[model samples]
Target: MTDETLHLRRLRSPIGRIEVVGDGRAVTSLAIERDGMLPHDGEDESGDPVLDRAVAQLEEYFAGTRHDFDVPVDLHGTAFQRAVWEQIVQLQWGEVVSYGDLGQATGRATAGRAVGGAVGANPVPIIVPCHRVLGADGRITGYSGGEGIPTKSWLLEHEGVPHTVPASARPRATDVTAAELDLPADAPAA
Candidate 1:
């Protein structure tokens, strides 16, 4: 890929520090730092408009003041990956979808594994809402952002989405039925 002028900004959030990268006009990527430290490979331009907007919106999201993001994003990825991310971005704050559901949405109903791969490859996790996806049984399969499964759990909790966390980290019983969680009848047990 050709090198482009990029701007970077880091924001501290409830989860951790997030590093946002933009190409002056639109956000390119958002990386959640595991240890509150981010690699400085781009110019730390605090005044770049796009970076500033992304950081502000993300802060609003973490504060529970923003339910959706409107900042412009220039995602670079394969066509299928882009398509998957597009569908992911349409997810509402409290909504959750399974990998199989996403595969169906993308017209690749049997490509759950491929859909998972695309979700895992999402460059902008929270912005695209990749954490909103789960396994077929409504279990959090895994996460490719921040600290992995724990980060996904925090995001799900923040959104009030009913999901099955690992047994060790679960706050409620794993056998809670859909009715108990107030989910649809067809929803998988939590």
Candidate 2:
């Protein structure tokens, strides 16, 4: 049997660095990590066309001219997880949905926790919109990205989604922030 090779590529975005993976014809996964991040364990065949396209699309996204990804995607996950991720793609640009709401939207009302796990494993982050999913109390929750909840909050703000942050959720002005990405916070939301 011929082994299917997974190809990967790295791209820099306004948010941070991204690692994209593909199987020649379609994207298999896309992740946002730190500047010096490396590809998944032993999965670095960066010289592939699919990866190149993914990187290009990401560049367009960061430039603020693209809203959707057109490249084919080969998502690998259980049926439930796939369902959750599929629902994620339906989130509107400046809207946020709670995990419980997503579970109900998928007809799995009792599976909110399962949906959260699926969101955590979303192969494609921005494109699939796991960042749009919030906690039961309409607050930011977990983010697979290393920077954690802060990344989630930043993404929501960047998208112009109004997040209801608890008083304790507020960050100090000097706390190593990503807020500087788009200068002049009042300069128009998206």
Candidate 3:
């Protein structure tokens, strides 16, 4: 594998400034800038084509004009983490998958907590859509990116799911029908 230097560029967004990092072939990471502000007069795009594509897609997303990302991600993770990330990628737009559901989807029925760990460690947060993962009871749970659970709720809301509520007051999880998730009738939620 060629070792490419990570190139980073800044993109201004309604929520804040997002720093995008990538090699020439694929985007490696996109994270919210800590200050939530962009410089007033500098160039807003990273010159790399891959990063530019990601910026455009993300802009479309925040504007409600696009629902899914098209840019490829050079996701770095352990084998198990990669499996977990794949399931995250397969999640349909506007659909929220519980951590337990994600674990079962990856054939690790008893590894929900482990899957949650992997999800939190995801390198590319928004593009990979780890924010769509929820608790088993439909309650919003741990989110390590940006503003944490609030950020998770924001992303979910952006995707047309208004399931955000304080953890203490979250409603009971909606019935996770087997048909909706494509699991066998004998599967956990089935």
Candidate 4:
């Protein structure tokens, strides 16, 4: 059971600090920094039931142990944004889709820029898998969520996809988790 207040919490990942917001029943928003100020300080990981579940899932994801997220989501977006987000969720782990392609998937084949706008505003990045979306030529463009495009590439690499990082940058394993890695439980056999 939860009090009536909206929930928020800070979770430290190998990448950086993550701020999560929820309404007790479902996660509403997740950001890298302490996402905007709320009325009440949300309980820590172990104290809030909703937060505890979210943190656990995120930790498992960073460890490359879980692929899909099963938690309920409470996204507040316009109808078009909701449609785009729904398409994003359909993307399987390790799969990447171009912005134009996403527009097509949402039956808005000519709304590529509009699609990009929605992708940028995606309140939840990882679990909804917004990083899985890309620009033309399958190259990464702007990704302001979490730790930025590096985290996106890292996520792709973790998913066993050959993703290109910025410049000569390569994501070190330590950027993901501190614990010894578990042999990627479900990385697709190449």
lDDT (CA) per prediction: 0.77, 0.70, 0.71, 0.73
State the displacement of the C-alpha of residue 31, model 2, in Å, after optimal TM-score superposition.
1.9
Best candidate, lDDT: 1
Cα RMSD (angstroms) for every candidate in the order listed = 9.4, 5.1, 11.4, 4.9
By summed lDDT, the worst window of 10 consecutive residues in model 1 runs over 172-181
Screening candidate 1 with a backbone cut-off below 3 angstroms (N, C-alpha, C), the clashing residue pairs are none
Tell me the TM-score of model 4: 0.79
Each prediction's number of clashing residue pairs: 0, 0, 0, 0
lDDT by residue for model 1 (1-190), tens: 2244657888666566678877778888888866445655354545488788788787667656678999888888888888899999999999988888889888999998899999999988898899999987889988877777877888888788888888765432123343533344663221
- Tell me which of candidates 2 and 3 scores higher on lDDT: 3
Question: Can you write out model 3's per-residue Cα lDDT over 1-190, one digit (the tens) per residue?
Answer: 2224546666554344567778777888777644444322243344578887887787667656677888989998899999999989887788888888888888998997799899999988888989888886777877776656666666776667756568553322223354443334554320
Q: Give the TM-score of candidate 1.
A: 0.82
Evaluated against the true structure, the overall lDDT of model 2 is 0.70
Candidate 2 positional error at 10, Å:
0.7
Candidate 1's clash total is: 0
- Candidate 3 worst ten-residue window by lDDT: 169-178
Report the lDDT of model 3 for residue 27.
87
Q: Give the TM-score of candidate 2.
A: 0.77
C-alpha-based local distance difference test score of model 3: 0.71
lDDT, residue 117, model 1: 93
Off by over 4 Å in 4: 1-4, 34-47, 166-190
lDDT of 1 at 65: 67
Per-prediction TM-score, please?
A: 0.82, 0.77, 0.77, 0.79
